[model samples]
Target: MYTDNCYSKIDNISVEYWRVGIYCRLSKEDEGTGQSESINNQREFLKKYVNDAKWTLFKIYIDDGYSGLNFERPGFQDMINDIESGLVNLIIVKDLSRLGRDYIQTGYYLEKYFPEKRVRFIAVNDCIDTFRESAANDFSPIRSVFNDMYAKDISKKVRTAFNIKRAKGQFIGSHAPFGYLKDPDNKNKIIVDEEAARIVKRIFEMYLGGMGLTTIAYTLNEEGVPNPSRYKKTVLNSSYVGRNKTMYWDATTIKWILTNPTYMGSMAQGKSEKLSYKSKKFINIPRENWQIVEGTHEPIVSKQEFETVQKMIERKNNQDFKCRKTPRLFSGFVYCGDCGSYMTYNAKRNHLYLICSTYKRFSKEFCSRHSIQEKTLISIVIEDMVQMIQKYVDVNGIKDKTVGLSFKDGKKKEIQDDIKRCRDRLEELKAMVKSLYTDKVKGIISEEDFLELNKGFTDEKNGINEKLQKLEKKLAELDRKEDEKREIEDIAKKLLEFKTLDRFILEKLIEKIEIYENAEIKIHYKFLNPDK
Candidate 1:
């Protein structure tokens, strides 16, 4: 009876042929482990075992240098595809850990997947074979729990190492920002390339010259200055560069360059961080949490110029009033005398009138209407403008007086010298920091001492930075005054040919008009200076 039963079992095993696939995984984190766990070793062992057992060697799937914490692996998916296509009836791996470290996924495959498909699964190192077992006999669940613990330990170690690097102010990102290149000698350092750096400087200068972000962007495109992403791709040979080829200007790109502190040689990091190891989401941290290392690289823009642009943007953004209506020949030129507010246009009964905008918006109790006939105001402005224009033409001296020179040659030289000196000092400090880092790496200086000295140098560097900022501001002020003089001179020369005032001339010349409570008016003209 025993011999007959054994023969029946052998017949049952021969009913299906086993086509086996080898799975191999090697994580970068596990590089230091024994060679037995290496991908090559796993492949070799699986091949030899399959050949000796007379099983059909179907294929090998490998996920090299990948973490086993998740089952979102490419090779693993390919093996699953083979199973669904009836090409592979059995799966083989060197160990259970190679399959995956996620316990839930491992258990799902072992308990449910293999049985439903009549697929055999085997882990050689763990001595677990699914083909000879009932559902209750499988020990994969216990093995998966251990694999998960291994993954958790690896994650903790990685986090600790990252914290240490961050504290040292080393650049740990895979890619640097636009206009900077990672130093070849030191991966943690960044150096500016002159060609790209010049482009960055031009962008900043255009922004400070009163150009709107969109307008500046359009000008850049027209001038054929390569956009940031395209420039990076050309220089770095990166395949991941932005491929948008429409060549249209975008305001967001201009705004990003204007706001980035990196252009000032400061490093700002930790803007966003991962929520957890399991979650792929990131959350932004507060600015206070940012790790900033100043004077870490070469600067393309001065701190003062950056600050000036920021202040200009803030002023415009927070303005309380909106002046949408275009000024007529004398609409904005007139103001109310009593309330000291702008004289706004009011049309009634086929006649135009000027009234105090502030008084009308608030209430009669606040101020008087300060009304005046628009025709009278227009007639008066036309007479004054014509007289001014004629005077400019007659004497040939209005250009010089109206376009007054404000910058002294000696002051400009002094400001330039001050800026040069500060920059020289900054470069010297950077060289010293680099030397100190070399010493620390060679064990000539202890880590603690290096940090202390670095902090001291940083403080001194910041002080010099403040001085440099003051000098740059003085330079910008001088430049603005010079531009104003030139603009007024040009406008005076143009106005000499005009016979009478028109809407186009009025729009170009006047900014606004304020009216007071007594019907007196004041005109504020557009500053001729581009810097203004």
Candidate 2:
């Protein structure tokens, strides 16, 4: 009878060995609470508990810096996986909140899931053990609801802090936009990156030269120029340099560049906002609703260029032509002399005629139907462009005129010398500012006096700098004009190659062909009198 009692006790002891999975989670908010709230601390506590009870330790699952609001914690998922595979017969956590703060999800997993799988769930701090729960355990549901409310409160506080920073124009992002970067000293301040800024200027130049957006994108791709997104990736990762991926060009991307007011030295914000506190959805506000602050930053595109392009786009959209099936050489270029509307093309008796587009809107007598034959118009335009090109090629004539103008304008040399002196002084001031720290450290000046003196110097320097910059810009404009004259001369030298007019040549050279009443036409070519 004593041997039978020993065998029964052995069976009872074997049944008490529980295969336990320990889970731990630490949120960002709870990081500085104490070491006791840490993942390691939770693991140590559960290990002691399991060891003291002589339970079998299956695994220790941990998720660090994760939110308690969701049960999607990595550690919790791993524990669930062990349970599903029959590796764990029981789950243990430091507290009920460690499992999840979400009331519905927490209740479902505890009551339904654990029961169905025959797994014992226990929260050591909560003193809740499923194996020994009584009718008083009804209060567990209320505790879960309180935990969910705490999560909601934490989420609201985080969102409010983010909005305050955004309103202050602080860059709450990892990366800045193209052509600019966050200032190292102050993350809120945006600073120009000269190398990237040069590329941006080139893009604008190419666009102004009549290249389509797609063509410009293709050219940049061919030259191995990185797109904005790809450039950002490389800048952020030095080890991943030269690993560029091709970006597909689309109308929306091009439109983004055209519409961005940042290029105009303005800050545009609040273009999009969240729909609600609970929803992650965002809705884009209209442009009129966007908060724009002018002169907030340095501009990439000039105000004049931006405005001019806007007008050109509007004009192009308003113009209509009847020769849609066949491309008219001057479809967008021609304007009716009477109505100032775009002229439409008509083919009758194998003769193409350009007529007033406004004839349909009003009586013929209201506006004389300005009409010109296509053949005659083309002949006139071609002859006029060739003569103009020939005139541009007369280098001796140009030299004589330039010499005559120089003699007439004696004050030009003196003005240029004064501008040069101002520019040199501005450069010296900039160099001085950059090296000011060394002077201070060497005891050349006291810190207080140095700062005061530097402020006055900076004020005076800025005044001179602005004037110097204006003068330099004027000089650049003159230089560009000279370059254009030279380009015209080069084009003129190749005029002999075009013995007859063709669509390709005409489109490349001409800007417009204006047909007036009495069948009179005027040609406006690209290089004709570029100096004017």
Candidate 3:
């Protein structure tokens, strides 16, 4: 009950315009079955069908070793291009599953896209013709769903097999890790590559010998020793293209090599997995979730040596963390009103004072030291806090009619500029650290000198970071001035019980305190003009 004249009657187009394109697909799971689903079988069957239909054969598009779960195949895209260009008006496939197994996409193309594009589609084995009205055409969606289920089943089986192999300590990756090679007798097994293993052992030794990661990388690069990726391509004769442009080692590469447990004779697998059967993206599994089988291969570094290196790295990181400068009472809340720079704390024989950082660090031509006594600043801040609490109690709000009560546009711009300057300085500090490592490696600076200079830089970096955080918070409050009444009232209520200013209370109540050369202070409250 199939009619060949369905498309001709519907579009009023003649058979001379019917240029047929035959599409054949053979998935990896379908290969070596020696069945009718072979690539050649599908191609020949579809070709004969097109010839018998008295249609002009435009071209044969074939996608071999492709998954039916996805439609990113090269040949499929090429056929679509011809269809859009009006070179092929009809498409013939051996079966529906050959076109695609994704049920949603298959349904879209069959029921909507093909009809809108004015292209006729035919599946020879499935007895499907988009232009024809038949029971088989109506049942296409159900058949597509079944095909999708089959694909999902196949994917699950493949993943289960891979996991089984991983549990058995088999190597399943396409290429071995940098320090090993796949066993010649068994591809699932690995053996140490002495050439690369020697380099791996030397990296551990260099770290234990007090050479930093950057220094080790620089020393290896200076010796013209090829990095892991370069060694794989040139020495091991591999076709790996990953990180191919990196001809020299870096601190990141050195760290990964040091932290990885593979060099200690453990076979680590299942470190990552595909997001889903239909997605090409992979998500990394946590370290504890990875399947690790120890003593699976020869270890380049002994377990004891590896454990020692890990502890050393941890201790170094802890030292750096502990050395960061702790926040002082008015550390980030004070600034120089004259130079618009943060004021640095100076304790001169128990008499604490804040001086303009710009004048203290650089030439005095840049700025004057707007010094103010710490005790005077504290008294001014406490008075302002009491005034704020009284205002809130007087009118049940903090809004005042004073001209300077609200944050001006000029103050907002200054905060934005400070953020930009801090970000730029951070970048410069990064470059300086890199240069410091290079200097240490080249003997341009002694170990003692490097440590001394690095400590100073670290302190300055930490202080700038604290100042940036306070500036950003002030800017955010200025932008979101509305809907902050309740929060401001709560803080004012707490200030009523405090007579002296502490670090936490000062930070919560005041945004910034600008000091001038005459010991004058201007307090910018966090909830200035709260009712507005």
Candidate 4:
């Protein structure tokens, strides 16, 4: 303590009056059944110390239920603002951890920020006062490092506990999935909500019953079926805020609900992981890494229905289609046969046609204008499809559009072989790396040799891993093709459904149409070899 800007007291007095800001912080980890580190207790101790020292108590700043890893607390910011404004010259806390648990920031405040502003700091319990001689002042930084480590260790233990709960099939999410509710008796258990579950079941049924995502979404919206987000917001009366205000049914939302395993009585955890204990950012984890506990709750839809819907969604996926804008029949499906380029929509006078992209860009220098009228192409498609319904296999439209054909019967086998080879190579690499480590341990190879060989193996393994990822993606495409192939007979039966071509029906059937210069159109059917 000082009076008149000097350390010595006036008239044999050892204490002086100074404005003090009492700060108290309570983290979630510190919510033990004790008043020792509670906000009120910290305030009481700091206020008593300030009062005993005859200092003026300016304000008490309390940040409750905030982590100490960051200085983003509302109370902490207010205290700093006051300090900056010269409202308080001295700061007092029950302990250093109350100041902060991050050693770097704590060290900055203790060593740089506080001193630079000519503010005296005190930790009452630790007997740390920057005024008089004490060994505690020298030990402050070390104590801060220990506090930081404590916070880190506590974070790890909490995460470990959560992982244990997940392993036990406990529901650890703050909110249950949309169609389910957390059990009133047990927070870890979930039970189906009949009201929301009906909506989930309806979405799945509509998707599997040959309805396109947009049609299903629009139908739900038209019927005033509360979408999942809205259902969560209004039905549950949730206090939690969400990203969307107007929760109309969207194709993406319907698709997510259809694909979610939670509706099928499966507990899905570890889909996303936080960046770190100190950060709120999160990233999606791969499916293989996800922890899924099957039959954990009452299913809203049958497993067979769920699996069928998954296959249907994959077959109807837009990767093989394009935009869903109505009245635009051949947006992404029309191409130029001569130049092997996509066709662009264009208008010349009153006529609408699909023109070669090459000719459209280079003015016939690259390729001739392989133009075909949209009306003509549609008539031919309807006639061919009608004919196919009678017999089942007339693919005359595969002639000109063979350029974009991505699959053949043998192509699937080749992709399967590539996948098998990648898996075998991965297993071989694992064994090789294991043997290299064994060789080092057995003294068969020197440390230098082991390091060099290990590095080489790791580099090769990483390269193989990248190839494996691409190969797996290709395998998924092949699987989708197989699914598409089996549904050809089913598709032929729906020829009448295409009589009035809507956007969804159109996207479900046609793959592409290639136009030639001679007014010929080659139409490709999805998931079918025309020659078959």
TM-scores vs. true structure, each candidate:
0.54, 0.48, 0.58, 0.57
Q: How many residue pairs clash in each candidate at the backbone level?
A: 18, 0, 0, 0
Ten contiguous residues minimizing lDDT sum, candidate 4: 397-406
Question: Which residue pairs clash within candidate 4?
Answer: none
Please report, in order, the local distance difference test score of every candidate based on alpha carbons. Answer: 0.73, 0.68, 0.82, 0.77
Q: What ordering of candidates by lDDT runs from best to worst?
A: 3, 4, 1, 2
What value of lDDT does candidate 1 attain over all alpha carbons? 0.73
**Candidate 1's residue-wise lDDT over 23-128, tens digit each?**
9999887888888888888899999999888878889999998788767889999999999999998899888989888888888888787667767788888887
Better of 3 and 4 by TM-score: 3
Candidate of highest TM-score: 3
What's the CA error at residue 494 for candidate 1, in Å? 52
* Candidate 2: segments with Cα more than 4 A from true spot: 1-16, 29-54, 69-73, 134-137, 179-198, 208-210, 238-246, 261-270, 274-280, 288-532
C-alpha displacement of 21 in model 1, angstroms? 1.5
Alpha carbon RMSD to native, model 2: 28.1
Candidate 4, after superposition: displacement of residue 240 in Å?
2.7
Model 1 lowest lDDT segment of ten: 1-10
Error of 2 at 234 (Å): 4.3
Superposition error at 215 for model 3 (Å): 2.0
lDDT of 4: 0.77
lDDT per residue for candidate 4 within 352-447, as digits (tens), equals: 777777665434445777777778777787887665455444454222222233356587788778878878988998999899899999999999
